[model samples]
Target: MAMPPNSVVPTTEHTTTTTTTSSKPMEVPVKPHHDARSPSFLRLGLYPITLKFEDVVYKVKIEGKGTCCGGEVSMKEKTILNGVTGKVSPGELLAMLGPSGSGKTTLLTALGGRLKGKLSGKITYNSRPFCGSMKRRTGFVTQDDVLYAHLTVTETLLFTAMLRLPNSISQDEKVEHVEQVIAELGLTRCKNSMIGGPLFRGISGGEKKRVSIGQEMLINPSLLLLDEPTSGLDSTTAQRILTTIKRLASGGRTVVTTIHQPSSRLYHMFDKLVLLSEGSPIYYGPASTALEYFSSVGYGTSITVNPADLLLDLANGIAPDVMQEHEQGETTEKDQKLVRQKLHTAYETNISTRLKADLCGLDVSNHINQAKEVATRNHVSSEQWCTSWCHQFHVLLLRGVRERRFEPFNRLRIFQVISVAILGGLLWWHTPTSHIEDRVAMIFFFSVFWGFYPLYNAVFTFPQERRMLIKERSSGMYRLSSYFLARTIGDLPLELALPTAFTFILYWMGGLKADPATFVLSLLVVLYNVLVAQSLGLAIGAILMDVKQATTLASVTTLVFLIAGGYYVKQIPPFIVWLKYLSYSYYCYKLLLGVQYNENDLYECSKGVHCHVVDFPAVKSVGLTNLTVDLLIMAMMLVGYRLVAYMALQKVQ
Candidate 1:
């Protein structure tokens, strides 16, 4: 195992004891660096990771319920990866090439420790078990770019650095690392630009992909695994991304990426290639040597033809008939299978066997002895958290605020709030005391308007960010509680603003209570009710990851609450009285009515020479006499809904 010309071997010292299935012990040298008190990036020396997988097979079970007489359930097993074997040494860029449904992504996920299927094989790092600590040192970039659309590239990377880098690393050092990565990935031009999505245009697709890569690179991973890094990018952009990956590999990190039908020039960038078809390896060797092996197996191509296209064609079992002209007889399915078997056997005999031998038999007693001189550094424990919980909450809160403020349709939301307020105010303009029905109608409209508006708006919150949340949470960037709390706190001000405007317009225009204390209390109650509504929406969104489903559920629940609201049903049925207690709208309506009219207030029943006077009890009739109890109940609903939403988020990842 010789280091590549571009590889940088660390100057520090550490010892790793490799324990195999056998009782014997083997020593391996792992370079160490400055103590934990030192900066993380400074301590990240040439920690080259050599990833090797032998006879790896991944299978998933699909269960179906039986429709027979016994009505039993049956399980079927599907093999995603069949006996896949390969080696990616330090400083080498290995590309896994395969067609759609060919298991390229699956294999990459398996290697990155993100796969959930049943797997059987030996995956080793530095000829030792790839434990949790080593897993933390690796980075995985999924096919989709999971990032904040509102945050600028610099802000995105800085927040990631704050959350993913260890606490021992100072904020200034983390910022430095983010800047270095930004420059390294050629993202300086877009450093201050937002990574926008469909609603808002910002950075280009290529730059967004670069930011995704930078996020994973922030940890200075020893092993970087990417799934389809160039899946949706143009040729030039794809080339640039691969070039960055090559540079990273040249720095002694093991880089493994899955590529789909890359250009010829892009194909040449890979040092090693693993071609797969139907979950089985068709070719696994040097990129330059692949054509030679294919040619020997009757799948050869001319120099002018794109080797990548030809390889993909063969891997897809669609190689042109002309390529098989060398064979004497007509081509058949049996012959194609035979050719594939021959290629597989050739790789097994000439490459896999030799690589395994080198890995098992090669001795570096001198390196181990040198590492033994210095105290064997303890295995860096799996990071419990990259930053403190408070830091995560603060960063997430800022990101949430930015996202909400810059949302493309946010102006429409504000307009909606204003429109609803104005329309309700115009419809019930200055209701008189003589018209008790109009006052009741105004209060009912206020309750229903605030309840439904906030509910629908907040329903999209969790579902929209579900992908980003899952990705970050799985990476151990922050605690779920921090994110939940930050989002709640971040959106509170905006949530209250709209309701406050609505309250201001309706309370005055509808001629509700004009007393200063009563007016302020009324506005507070409405705002709190809006919070409860939004919290319910958040819970629904988190429980159901799909926006349409969450919205439907929210609509149904809101309708139920509206119906049970006190105004809608003045005389409640004994059996369904408990349902009203569960409705936040009911409490809000009762509180608003209580705040507007007092027990001693008089109502004129008849208007004539002789007018009949009657006293109407607003609060006691609806069983909402105590304002404090109503406020307490509304607060409880707010917390209860938010708590449920948080619990739902915990189950998402």
Candidate 2:
């Protein structure tokens, strides 16, 4: 029978090898059934990634504050990963083990093609240099489960499938794929349940982790890289997750993950292990032989103790000898250094040779040639985008609507809008046409209220979604334009709903106008005003990815717009008169006043006396006579602000 691509077929018996040292020859453990043979390169309709890195080094710069005399700031260079070398073949699950700050996550990020630093080395997928195409073939599960809390499990996976799966796959196939993944991850029971967050309780932590895994699996990636997949879960949950990963590897894919102190049972699931300390590798080999190698080097632990814990303790310089001496007040920093040095020296002298020999046998060049030939035969490039622009927009639109509908803040905002509208109506209740001051007060209040509410709500847009956006965009899942356009269009219903309610209540209750056309026009102007305000807020949020800073900036800008809105001071000086033209509120207020009191409308006294004042002077005071011009200007402001927001988002990324 022909073997599947990257699938290993095990034999009944396994052979063992030993390394010879000066003291004695140490017996190596028998290879596990899963790792007994190398996987063959055959076309199985899935590209298997063979990742290899040699002498990978990454450095970052740290900037400190300047001295009192304004001297140059202190700059320091820190190495995150040094001389890290390893190879993970298809059908293998490699676990990177180390203590805190040991550069395990850093190395994982580098291999995922998400790291930005001064990196020097060779990183290849099936012997071809890593490129944007390989990034799509790889799935990266971050430490935290960053998901839409309001979306159900099925919806979440469906959205990912729609955006990440190639367009050649039909909608039916996408749905089938999502269902398959759901069933594979054992999430069928909670398929319709929401993935809730702090405010709501939905699925269990383990279920959430599974959902995260299922999301990446939707695209059927060749290589999966996870950072701390079992970080916050219990032992049972972590074991289940690791088991799922191992099963995935057995299906002819490569899996790599970084884990903190894992239980013995969990550690045994990994096919290979890379032990790191302070950004340097101490040992790299088959997971079953790790303890044997350590024992041969005089660092064996008690049979009852977990080998993973022993490895961590040794790597962190907290071995039994060092810990015992420290408890007895007889250990120093130098003594701890000596213990680490001894382990490193032994691994280099005795185990490195065998590790290199095994890596050399991977035949990465052959795997690369096979993959290229298969991809060419299928007329598909791994780099092709999964979804088209229209498809991406459609998926994003649905997700944005779902998220906004369930957001507690949005519901609260609706209530607040109704309350504020009712209060404003009561405060300026059914005023007479002769009361010019009351009319002006109502119009000014309307302008300020709508502007402030939308601006406040919009400031949270980009700041809240920044991390998710960065992750998705970095993976080349979709273009920035598609996201921006979808988000802007997605928010239209909610954005217009509240303002429409406010206008309807405030317009009739305050006795502004009884004409149907005037009411509709006033409503349209208010909605446009809200959109302009929200666009400014989006731009501010994108420019400053901090909620507090964006809020503060928005408040100040709103204040300036309100002052120049031609409400407080009708006769403005030449120097500051131009500011009114830039304010959306100015044009919105003008349009509202014009629509209510047209050129022929009269403001007569109510005591059966015809006054000389035919209409309120509000239109001419702010130099806005033509209602069409004012409406057009408001429209322009809407588009201009949205354009600026789009540009800001692109620039920031």
Candidate 3:
């Protein structure tokens, strides 16, 4: 059977809101619940089951000391939110309401299975806690918009959609779906607009919020959780968002969010409003009853007051109305205490049960079972590994290539190549009068210098792209490997383009008196060096994750590799000699000399005399062979770096 939209299963069962009165309100008795037994990992390591949390209590310790008490720094960690409980059923919008610092965002992250704290309660999804299959099935949108600033709005969504959407859908279908979401979020005007800094701008704050919502929606999660969806927005915009949320919930999607100071007009839209103060539940129920519940306990409705403000007032402390009533003998202080006890008791009995009943709505177990069954039935064999990898890599590779074509620096490579040609031609006219060793030094120096620009570009490029990737990766759109591989492969041609052009210009102009095969071999070695440098850039970018740091590290490392590469110094210290072996410069220099110069040429150089005669130092075949070996070694290093990056990215969560 086809699943319902947002996965809500229809039922005739209904729940009614509860009410209580206080003129010295009667307190309900409290009862302890039986703890859920932990499951055995051995017998059901991969068995699929839904995650459930019943009677969940989360506490955050706040630090402070009373002014009257000791003025010492007290290790008192007050609870920010306590006895908080809710259920995220498929196809529902469950909004969690609280004022600022009420631990709403904390609860949102915890529900996403990503919070760092001690949780005293049972949280089971797919029969697993946080690390099981439920994580894959859920989509979390944080308070901050972690988008790639440089990518266009459409490009951002499309790239993520391509990775998250199953291959069962056609390209056209996928595009249509993404477009629909964009339109739904009202980002059509900025659809093709870039997602970056001042140079790249698009979409309004409200539209961006919707797009963020869309990003998670792309995964088609059964339950959607948003933190402060209307934050930093105008009252009008906030209402529109609330309207959309209401519609989303009405349309069978479960939407839960923590909103701060929602407008009175917007307050009526919430299906459920959970009130929190000093880390305790003050009220939890429908919006209509919120005012009633407070008024029944002597709060009574206030004229022209924001409902959120009223809730905060009572949660923090009662006002002078209570003291005035007490002095008038209308209500005693004992009665006030009795009212608070009754309200707390009602919340524990009525509100907690309603949330528990709603917990049954989520079907995390079913989804996990579906994923496992799909995996087993498909039986993706070892032979399909190559095909699977290619499929995964292609999605990112195509995006990277497209991004490059439109990149501002696209024409810079051509400019670099032309500049190299012009400069090398100028040097050709004054051709060095030194020995063959002098010419060898000139060729090596220029090649190393030529490699610098691309390395610098690679290093800086990833830092900018990482902001975009982090947002995409967090949304569960694609594997990190796809991003790293696609970027490396997509930019490979651009990386090699300038260096290859430089090699041709300098080789012919410098007139190295070498055969065509030797010229080609030398060119290959230099190009491989450029590739290795690019990989080095990627590794540094991944480690630092900062633009300034990565750029600095790349520049310094490039210089070290060039100097210690064995081109300048004839001999290095025994302790530092290993640096030569570690440097790509050493390989490129040794292999180039072996390819271009003969053994006799080296001997003549040692004799301290310039030699220009043809075959003066007969060239050997050994040097030509070393070119292939050196290039292979450089290729291995590049691959090894990429593998390390891939491993590191997988552990980012």
Candidate 4:
């Protein structure tokens, strides 16, 4: 049906319209909803979906505030969203307005199908249960911008487009989509700017928010859900972000956002308003008619004020100036309770009854579900990723490298490694033929430093990225296996680059051996040790998703390994000697020694005297031997630790 000029579009399903000329909202005539034609409100290539829910009651278990008797733990159920019920239609912007602790964020999460607790409700998309297919079609931009701070704006959107866009679309088309989104969000100027974090500065707060929205828009989603996208921004930026959202809604998208204390102008942009008070609905209807409805119920704004401000005051159970006539100043607890009760009762009697009626008549989704077309349109959410496994790996590989490439090779790190390498070379430079202990000390330092350095560097990887991982994984952007493999493999070149450079300079300067094969073998052991140590760090980080704890464990583990590697003490206590086998550091030390010296090689005993050092107690204790076992052990560790890490990541939930 064509709408008249200067008319406000219907706010929600079968609701009334308020035109500029009318002071009161005009009721929309009810049409026979039983017709088989789908009621999706837009045609954005994909059919627009009407998101509906009824009687949504979400509760969570919380620890009791009271002291537990007999040292027993106490638990209680807290209602996060108490019987929250509302629906959003395609091409309509529904802003969930409420004060703090009113369950706005909780309600938004539930709507996005990301809520993870006990929820009792009838939430259906196109009258179908939430599934994998809907997750793909739905674009959920979290309240906090969850983006890679290191990636430029264009790169961030491009990576998302590659992973989220269907494989049937050509690469060129995906790039075009990214550009279009950037342009649409007014981000073309800052396309190349980084989405910086605490460590760096890049885009403005508003631009960052826009990038978050653009990430979702790239996919051309039918439904867009945002949680406080205007949060922590100045009024001007907030208004701009809301304006972008309104335009997106106008272009046939279902938009639902939780807003806190929006200005009157911003409040007017919302097509519908769901005012919540302590998890219960106080009002639900067209935004323009909210004050009208409240006025009929004996509590309404007396003076000209932002509708959002009035709604928030009502949500907090503090009546607007209208209540000031009864009592001066602040409302007491009793007064608040009374106000809340009255408003909730009014909503139940006047608004909820009508909403339920409209929902019944507008449940075209359920009606459509029985048709064969439903199955053709919807699928289980298990078929999660839009791209194939190889394609996901490729896209993730690019993204991971783009994010982490500079981390290991930044100027400070480069200077640190080079300085250490040069100092080690000069300190042990061309050790005299008799200084066996000095050469041995340098080799031991190599093992300790490589083992310790790389372990700490990699230990914080998983913990730092935990939030980003959870956000992306929850959306089913890519499989955990692909992400794990991509992150690990992408870091390989960067991880080994400095180690190779350090070893190259240190090896020639130390002048332990002149043979080409010996030098190569020694370098190989150092690089291999670097990799094994990094694997240990990855395992620890993944298993214990806390950075401080992981760092502490890595420190203790490395110290223990260094002590047990047979260099610190010539003799070991038999009982605790098993720790040596558990330490990759011990294996690596033994291998480096094996590369430089063997049983037959002799060092000067003293003053032109020569003896087989391998036969002596000190050299024998170091356990220099033919190359097989130590190398094999470290190699096994390189694989085994990463396997454990992968398994640990699988249980993150």
Candidate 5:
């Protein structure tokens, strides 16, 4: 469980922490979370930041339509966001409007520093690159809500508050902050309800969306990027959410959101807008004047039409005449493509040149400030992880337990474990020790079943949490060491519970050994084997990151172990018989036998059994002299497998 000293160290230049301040909270139905009533974030003296990007182009190499002579795939460079540009000063809300494939989320991901691959652009916060400080200072909410279904809204927000807020803040303050956020987001009504998934109902969509935003709000972030925050909600709900977002932007924070389509009122609420079409900027300017700007450029607009619907229509290359074509009859894709081309040409000819000019002028100040800002930002970001190694371990461990306590307690799983134990005990009930072969079979079965049961269950652990890990890690919530250690430690007691119960019941009913020392040693051996099995599961799962693939590999791996375990085929080939030394099942079975009989005090001898029972055909490998070696090897595998998993997970991004 111990990690290297540097493993938990933050990934930036260590420096003093800074707190971001915001403007006074706006009046609303519920009380605001800022001003004097805000969370203790004010005491932190954090700085507000402006978001600026220029020439932000993102492209990917995708498979082309045609293949090579030998049927090899052809490649083509596909541009997703073609030289998109904008800037959002603090206290302004900028909205990105585009069709489904127009690169809105991709741009948002880039702003959050979560996008991967070829991105050529100038993206900065406070004239600095996306360093650790801005990472902690920024909050990015994805289009879909990613949350624990079982966690109540309050618990969800409280947990985030505890982990995300600086450790310097007290427990009471964190709770109070959670309460204030609950009121601010109008989530007070559903505070106690669960954030349910597709399988169950909990809070409404708007409430879930609010909880996602609240997670970021607890930090009072300087730069907040949300991808489609009001998507899939009614007009009233969407407006309320937008109103809250406006208030947040009013608090001297730079806010950028992607809107699919907004009502006229919601559209007017935005301070700035970036309109996109087919990965190209068709227009970028003030939200209020977008139509005016477009009208001056010669596209038609009516005052009675909702601006959002009209812009969407224009972005899709459907003009008033094209709508007429739709109303009267069918219009061709060729017509839409022609309109889209005209829009892009106008943007490039008129808007693109001006934006580039402004950007060229801005670059001088940026380069002058870049060096100092980087040093300062890195120093601040390095300090933003907030808690000591032990502190992180403590909180993560508790959260892990609370989050997973119900997993092993599921009624069907519980019944399965108990029923198997009872079934096994009945099958081998009170067998006489003289039946040496039968007793050995029982011990072997115990070793194999306990080892196999946990491996499959453990294989799914990392895959399920992969998205959560990436989200939290990108925010610098906790070091990977803390998460890995906390997860392994928390799972220990629960994973061991069923196996312990199974062993206690089976050992007595089967009457293999009555001595307390012998039973205790037997239980330790089984648990140790289980640990090794689960570690292997974790390693494979982390390496593959796909449940089905990991399970297939695990199944094949354990099958090899089972065959070489000296039971199914006692005579293994010399080439692979060495695998027995590697099989946890083999070592466990041998250890089980070794624990039953003492070296000096033998006397279980019979004509059919070896006088030194440890030397019995089923138990003896190299020698009982190597028992400690066996334990050491299994112990190495236990820790070694987990270390492999932790290392592999670090590459998962």
Candidate 6:
């Protein structure tokens, strides 16, 4: 047999010239624009590609009351794809051809290893069991375009490319890959353009469809699956996409997709067509033989109609109401019955048995069973030590920065800081004689109020990002750590800006005591406030994962903490006294009080001396010790809350 394309290419003269010449770097030759599905250039040291699925069956049960009548309705277990068994060899395209409800998409999910619900199936790629790591080898393009609304196509591709490909790959190489994928899918013309908003002005529907496919191809997945790739498209566009798909299969990558209705213009693109009806297989073979099998059983359907439409009509069967309501000389039950019988006999006797025999011969069944046993017995690595943990922190930081850079709402926090500082300074200006007691209270109040800014920002912004992040992560787009790390890095600059600016202005303007050390200490406390608040917001966001829920929880928690935070109301009832210990704000308050009053206890104000003044209980303790403790608690809160949120987020997913 000729060697499969999955095997490595030999180092021939052409290969050596391409691989070694730096002066003219080997560029993966771009295929002609019209040849949409050309194979990528063969590379050295690539892994083998293999696929296996065992008795895959996806079921959906409906048991809900009717919306209008409120009558109990129970749709018994409906098998979308019954006993679906097929092996996709490397470099093949399995086209699922069926009616609207034939469970085409459902079967695609099972085979793609993404569906959840009584999935009694085994899916393996390259002899490795399909799991989280295994998913890295597979890519799925859903029907909808999942592009970020605002980012340009290149930027969107770059963002995903950064986290997925290793740093060793030069930026030029990455861009080359993205461009290659674009060219491969015939997206070169709009490569640098903006992925349009809901209006979709920039690119055509066919271009958007190709972009969706390109996002998955960027990963160089061995198995690519799509749902309704040609849906809601013109026949010309549909045929164009299918042609690309056929080319991908020819390149030695297994491609599977469900298409609703394919015109004869696109029918030849399919390598194998699996027809389904009411959760059962009615036909599974070459597309050319489909009409022949039907006609032999007395259906005698003409090829004048679109093959996709004709097959669907035969499989779906005619409705009783339609047959009864029809006028004379319309489609009748006898005609439909004959067509159905033809399809049924063809599948029952020939196709199903052939498929079963094919499946039995390529039995990786034992390997799959053994892998499942090992997976069940294996202990989960410390959940605390998640893969790319530090990477997540980096992603989170970057994410924060991106939010400020991208979303206009974050600028409001800067406004709040400026407004608060100016307002506090004006209040101080009104009281020129800075009584030590009043100044102490002023500093404490400023520190306490500033914490709320980050809290509000995190609570509001995190929920939105959470949706996008979860969707991306679930699809295996990027590592969770990279996401977390980006958010953390991105937000740091913004997080530091408001507090740093406000604290510097207010520390000098509101003068009770002024020294280099004291100013620095006060600034530190203010920064801590930001971190603490942000951490709380993250924790709440992870716990709730809903905007309304996060908002409500953050509001209530802040209110409860403010009341119990030892500012205005302190002496709690015996029953609620323990809340003080659990409340994060309580610890923060203790640290602030320590910073404010530590100097007051040691210094006595006199007319002749530059001594610290002790005028009120608020000024009793103000020292480096209190400030240090306060800073420590805030750091703890920031890290502690984030860790807690991470744990809660896992459960949420």
Instruction: Write one digit per residue (lDDT tens) for candidate 3, span 1-653.
Output: 12233222221222222322111111212122111111110111122223354555666556666566656655555555566765444344556666567677877777776665666767665445665334444667777787655566777777667676566555665566566556555565566656554554445678777777777766555456788888899999988877766655554455678887778887777767777654567687676688887776566755767777677656544443564554466765566556556666767776667766776565465656654764465332222121245667897887666555545667866886778677866676435434554565565665576556666777765667665666566554555666677777888786777777877777777776557898888777788778777777777777677779988887788777777765566556778877766677667666776666544443344457655323332222113335566778887888987776666556554
Candidate 1 on 1-653: residue-level lDDT in tens? 33452244232222333322211111111222232234444454445566878888999888877768988889989888988888887778899998888899989988887777599988777667755566666888989998877777877888788788777677767777776677677776566666777776778888888999999888878789998999889998998999888878877778999998999999988999999987888888889888888777676756567888888878755555545552444666776676567666776776777766765765544333432331134234455665789989988887677656666577887898888788888878887877777877787777888888889989998998889887887677788999988987887777888889888887888777678898898887788788899988998998998999998998888888888887666677898888888889888888887777655665665674222222333333475367778889988988989889998888886
| Model 1 global lDDT (CA atoms, 0 to 1) | 0.76
Assess candidate 3 and give its TM-score to the true structure.
0.73
Candidate 3 local distance difference test against the native: 0.62
- Residue-wise lDDT of candidate 6 within 370-458, one digit each (tens)? 33443344322222222344544554454344324434456676787788888887777533343554655676676567666678777
Pitting candidate 2 against candidate 3, the one with the higher TM-score is 2
lDDT by residue (1-653, candidate 4, tens digit) is 11221122223223222312111111212232221122221111444677897989999998876655677667999988888777877678998989898999988888889888799989988777988878877888888898887777878888887888777677765666565566667776667667778776778899999998888877667679999999999999999999888877876667899998898879989899999999999988889899998888877665888878778888888877646643566557888889999999988999888988888888464334432343354322246666899999998998887776445346677799999999988888888757888888888888888998989988988888898888888777898999999988887886799889998998889877888999899888999999999999999999999999999999899889988877887678899878888988788888888888877888888788898867656457767764687778888999999999999998775
TM-scores of all predicted structures: 0.85, 0.87, 0.73, 0.87, 0.88, 0.75
The alpha-carbon lDDT assigned to residue 215 of candidate 2 equals: 84
lDDT (Cα, tens digit) per residue for candidate 2, span 113-142: 888769998888887777877877788998
**lDDT for residue 151 in candidate 1, whole number 0-100:** 75
lDDT of each: 0.76, 0.78, 0.62, 0.79, 0.79, 0.63
Better of 1 and 2 by TM-score: 2
Local error of candidate 2 at residue 519 (angstroms): 2.3
Off by over 4 Å in 4: 1-44, 65-71, 321-330, 365-382, 404-409, 616-618, 625-627
Error of 4 at 98 (Å): 1.0
lDDT of 5 by residue, 240-337 (tens): 89988887777667789999989999999999999999888999888989888778778876657999898998888887656878667687788889
